[model samples]
Target: MATSRTGLDEEFIGRLETSLDIYGIRQDPSLPPLQQTYMTVRAGQDGSAGSARLALPAFKGDKGDPGDGFLWQGDRTSAELAALREALGTDQRNWAYRNSDNNDLWVWIGSRFVISPDAFGAEGPEGPAPILVGGTVTVNGEALDQPLGTRVVGSDGVYSLGVDLPELPKGEPGDQGEPGSIFSSPDITGGPTDGQILVFDNESGKMVWRDGYLGPKVYNVPASAFGDWSSGLTGTRHIITAITIPAQPYRYRLDFDGSVEVSSILGQTVDVQVRADDPDTGAMVGVAYGNMEATGWVNQRFHAYSPDPFTPDTTGIRVGVVEPGVEQTLHVVAVKSAGLAAAWRVAGNGRSSLRVKLERMP
Candidate 1:
């Protein structure tokens, strides 16, 4: 009743013998005698010699010489590989690599770097052309004069084929808008008078026309107006001249330019002041001071005004504000400081005239 090697009996015997030996059945002998007998009978029926070995433990062989195969030095760039090659000259066994710039791998084959072909696979079949669902062509919103090709997302939220759009036509003319307000518009209240300018009125929130140029206004005081002050006039203040500033919406800057002949003892000083007062309330708005220090009959040019008039809450003179239709007055006054009993006088002549500059501020 021996079964040939060609049959399932032989195959079953071979597999069972391998499993028994792998489970250490031969060394341990833990199986019952009935099962052991059954295994022996099956092997005999399959015509396999009972003396044949199944899964014997492999014997350890002697260690061989170091391999002549390529040694993986580690990943390196092209420059690094070149340096390494120069340091550790070409041996057939050295290997180093860097990822290729393209989708391949660069390997150092000891002598020089070469691109490996293992990174690429066989060419795949061509894929079907992307189905274009739909798209839109727009103009007037932006200038796309040249034909543009772009991928568009369909309503289904998937990106389809790229759509090539031709140069779009110009959009139809839009409805005419209402005309905008000009200088003659009724929104601007006031004159079309000569030498008038358009200015915004914050109180009325409208544009207004006012007489005069928008630049600084200059006022020159005649030399005859600056009368001479005789000697022995110490501890006294004399009025030089008064300037009237017309009512306006903005604050004003007052600057002064003048010269005076000081007849005084050495080291004595004469001080001058420019003061602004509200004509209606008589309230002192601001004041600026200047001085001249000299000996007998010394003519000195003086620029008398606050260092910075536009700054508010400052220690010195500040910008002056005039109410609408109410004029402001600026007075130039000179004072001789008390000193030695020596008599002195500040004389004003043709060169002693004052020039006052008024600038409009926002």
Candidate 2:
């Protein structure tokens, strides 16, 4: 018998010596048709015919030296990352301190302050399992440690303090449009009461009010719910003042109708002192009076007489609808003083103007 043989040696095999590994071969026909081949004495095959498959079980690798770190030109590690958290073992009210525990359990991690939640457990003999709030690891690698400076080291990595955050502060105490708490009452004769919002008429603006006889709540009865601002004839006075503490405004259009001769006493000019008549009581609430004398002006005094009676406030002031028969006029006059007999000399027949302001409350 003629022998067709191939020799096998340690040089012919690598990892295969392990009995734990098993591999096999496939046909070269599995490869593209035209090809060159080599002889494998270990598998005892003519390489021209098939493919060899390699397999292995998993294992750990040998350690190697890691390289140097990154650069931010010339910034400190913390500076490179802008900011990092720091925990204080105890509450010291310091800007950099973050109370880590109720027991003043804190650590100065790096830069910013932080606070931790109640972290207590029986994972170890006495202490609880460490939490992974960044920068640290547990004694047994069971968890991450409370990150205080440099708990983590790496290649261009980030640092985290990982303390618990508190919730945010509340908003301004205004209308919260709550369910039963929000109501709209067209039935309202006055302002909207609690829960009910009354969008008043004769006004062109909207006033929002939340429940509470107590306010801060204001009504623009002349703008939105009630009157039209665009048209010169909304038939209602655009009450120009805020329903606020000062001259809480309410508008009216009074017409005396049919001309009557001006009363001589009424026509005569009198020294005028102006006031903001309080609506609550028809008493004079002086806002500004013309001071014929005084210097170093801090506040302005009334100097010119309005040809028409007018109110004072914001944008639309001195300008609004005046209803006929429902609005009247007010007058202001200023003069020099005289004698008891010549009272006309003190507050003379000299009148500057009649300020016919419409007072509408029909």
Candidate 3:
């Protein structure tokens, strides 16, 4: 073992360590520190290259290939509102996309790149993900108008979603229809002293009656469209009377309480009506037949005529007059059907009085 004194020359040692296949490479010690590759020294006289050098290049790997260009991930990382912008070459304009879940950006990969979700998004280490811009989420093409978290439980045709969401509200039915009308007769001091003149509404506005006392009706009646007054139609001795409107006006259908109807006053049959006022001139219009009648009075009976086809036409009411000696007997009176058109009263452009009788039967 002859040892020559080569005073630990730093330069000479550097070249030796840089050469491939050296014992000092793998162990990584300072024999001649000039590290660029990981090396291994082969020691065997029988081998082809007696002292083989295994050169393994070593350099810090880049912060990962900016990603395989295209990235796929699960839920987005951060909030969508705070997503970073990606500079994807010249096509930067198309890079316009609001953060879906959260982390959404363009990663740099080799010579080319792909649009992918942000690293922080889902599985940040895995790479990019699909950016869900906007999608169609509907049930059988029906739009989702309900608020989020609606308790929707329906399988095919069987629905069973009991609402449980905090925001979703319970469904409610529509408001009840205007109350069915309840009317009475009016007290007049004129006309046939024995005839009964009744008025009321049958849910809708159709007033009618007969000449004799009647009872409750169950079935609707069938009548003609003839608009002829029952001229001389006696009622306990009331007849021969005329009906006319104080003026002509384009009055509309009747309105009760707070409800309004669109059905025209003219029906398929006779459009019987009363005097309607003329809005422009306060004049009288053509005669429209009255729709109701009252007939029947053994006593001062109180009946409720729910505007029926015929019988029991009056409600808690009756048509009778007081005869001094005839046990205060009575006769039909002369009163026409009063409509809520433009003329229930002479008072213009204001609420007027309608004829609703509230009699005290004896």
TM-score (C-alpha, index-matched) for candidate 1: 0.36
In order, the Cα lDDT scores of the candidates are 0.56, 0.29, 0.28
Per-residue CA lDDT of model 2 for 160-201, tens digit only, reads 443442332343789767565233543334444323444444
User: 230-296 in candidate 1: lDDT tens per residue?
Assistant: 5463446566667776776555555566665556676555555556763323433333222334566
Q: Which parts of model 3 are misplaced by more than 4 Å?
A: 1-15, 19-37, 40-88, 93-111, 114-175, 179-362
lDDT (C-alpha) at residue 321 in model 3: 15
Best by lDDT: 1
Rank ordering of all candidates by TM-score, starting from the highest = 1, 3, 2
Residue pairs clashing, model 1: none
Candidate 1 lDDT trough over 10 residues, lowest sum: 32-41
Clashes of each: 0, 47, 48
**Tens digits of lDDT, candidate 3, 1-362:** 33444775334221122235333233343333333333444334444232343444445443545422333333333333234323244443233342355545533342343344553435434434323232333555554554434344444345554433233334478888876533432332223223334444465454444233322212111122111132122211112112221221211111111100111122111121212232222212222222223221101111222232322233332332112222111111222233223111111122211221212222
lDDT of 3: 0.28
Give lDDT: candidate 3, residue 343: 14
